[model samples]
Target chain A: MKKYIWDGIFKNNPVLVLMIGLCPTVAVSTTVQNALGMGVAVLFVLTMSNLTISLLRPMVPESIRIPIFIIVISTFVTITDYVMHAYAPAIHKNLGIFVPLIVVNCIILGRAEAFASKHTPLPAILDGIGSGIGFTLAILGMAIIRELLGSGKLAGHIVLGTKFAATPILFFSLPPGAFLAIAVLIALTRLRK
Target chain B: MIRMIRSLVLVCVVAAGLLSWVYLFTKDRIEEDTRQKVRANLVELLGDTTLTFKPVIPDTLWEFYRDTTKLGIIFRSYGKGYGGPIPVLVALSMDTTILAIRPATPAEGLKETPGLGTKVTEPDFTNQFKNKKPSQIKLKKDGGEIDAITGATISSRGVVEAVQVGIAKYLKYLR
Candidate 1:
């Protein structure tokens, strides 16, 4: 029971362990604020979609379950998209295309199939939260490293003063830098375990 | 199967209802947000929030005014940038000298390569356009005054062309 929560968070971590949803992880993690925004958005979608799928598991047929799951997940993703666009336009702009692409984010749909459909509603929601946290933690780590080393800023605030801020590594802020940072974090995670 | 169809229908109906509720709830707020944003951008560019905006082409050209006195008209033009269409806002002086150029939209979605072409939205790049005549809006490489961003000459040229062409077309309407 407890393993459901722990596994997704640490042992079977989506980004670091399973390597799912790497697109947004690499793309949006350029800043800590972006990472947190993406994380919260994913968390909401995952939890709601998982809950819906779990509640509908019985009525849904086996052969057509995947499409049904996608509908439920996309419904939640669209809700998140509209809500963010209305309220948090800054984050909405930064996230850009990735916000709509959350429909295809495997973590949301993967949990729906693997856990939500098979489990009861309460446990399914828990699994969703667990996986969401795991994904958030992973991306936050990536963002912290990328923002600090790449741009010398933390959550859009200047941290490195001016001397070091002028010529930040610059490499860490680019796509290659996302790869390098994630790799180092993954390795460190492995070492800690 | 009938069961599958029934289940899909039921789920879709529920999803539609929920989505409609959310959309209806946010429609006015979203519209207000857009209005506020455009108003704020106008204030930032013109340095005056009290000016009245009389739209000549709704979202494209507007005659700004302070009480009954005319200040200047603001023009918005879209440039075919390296990533996509970059929306450049140009506030022209009485003679159409470029008063200021702002990206007018967040450039993140444009997918321009980061650290280079995307810098077009940065004030450091856009500030170069301030007070330049339409003839001088070209890149230094093209014998004009503007300095092209390193490794992003295409984007730099895009902005120049957008402003030059946009200004040329709108200049006739200013009178």
Candidate 2:
């Protein structure tokens, strides 16, 4: 149990170690608020999809398993999208097309194919949770640096005051800045290893 | 082969059932929320006066009155932006001048590129339309009064075009 948790969250972190879902991690990590929003949505979709796929693993035939898993994952993604659109419309709008794009987030599908299809339901659920958290934490690190430098705000509140906020390093909020931030973080993590 | 088909069908049916239940649960709330959002946006733009909304075209033009006095008309305009459709909400005074022009939902509608075209949502861009007549709404490069966003001439033009056409329609409809 602990092994699965440790495996997904740290040792085999999806964003950092496995490097599967970098698209959204970079695209939406401009702000702490947005990163958190994406993280929560991914968490819900991942856990639900993983659980459903694991339970259906036996009945799902090998030849048609990939398509079947996709169907199951998309079902959960649509549910998450609608629920968020209905209730948390602000986050939905901010996240934009990425909500539906969760169907292809890769982390969710990767886990479904690699872990969920072969693992028990409980282990699959844990993997989903751990990987989701790992992804969230990884993006949060990038968001903190980006938001702090890019906008001088922490979750929309002014943190750096007039001095830094006046002439914010706008580069940090753009795509290139996302890459720079992630590269530096990845380098730091490598130093520890 | 038959077993494969059966398994696929069973999985699909179960997934469909679960999703349908969610759709049923959220349908009304989503509808209510959308209407409420549009209403809130209207109230925010028009202010807390005794404004009544009468749909001229239901989602296109709405006739709003403040305490039996005709205030103005609120209508939606679509601009073909770089990203896609940029929907702007235009409020015109009874005299045909723009009272306010805001992004329709404030968040959605404009999927303009981040930093460049997306600057269309910034007050520096949208604020240029406030109180301006349609004739004065075009970009400076096009011999109009407005200034285009740096490096985003197309997106700037899109907003102006949407507002210009929208006001023309409003005038024609009024006539």
TM-score of chain A of 2: 0.97
The runs of at least 3 residues in candidate 2 whose Cα sits more than 4 Å from the true structure, single-residue gaps closed, are A160-162, B44-50, B79-86, B95-97, B103-107, B111-160, B168-175
Model 2 CAPRI rating: medium
Of the true contacts between chains A and B, what fraction does model 2 have? 0.71
C-alpha RMSD of each candidate structure in angstroms: 3.3, 3.3
lDDT of 2 by residue, A108-141 (tens): 9999999999999999999999998988899999
Structure candidate 2, residue pairs in collision? none
lDDT (Cα, tens digit) per residue for candidate 2, span B68-119: 8777898998888887878888888887888887764335657777788888
Per lDDT, the best of the predicted structures is 1
Provide per-model DockQ scores: 0.71, 0.70
**How large is the interface RMSD of candidate 1?**
0.8
True contacts kept of each: 0.76, 0.71
lDDT of model 1 at position B155: 85
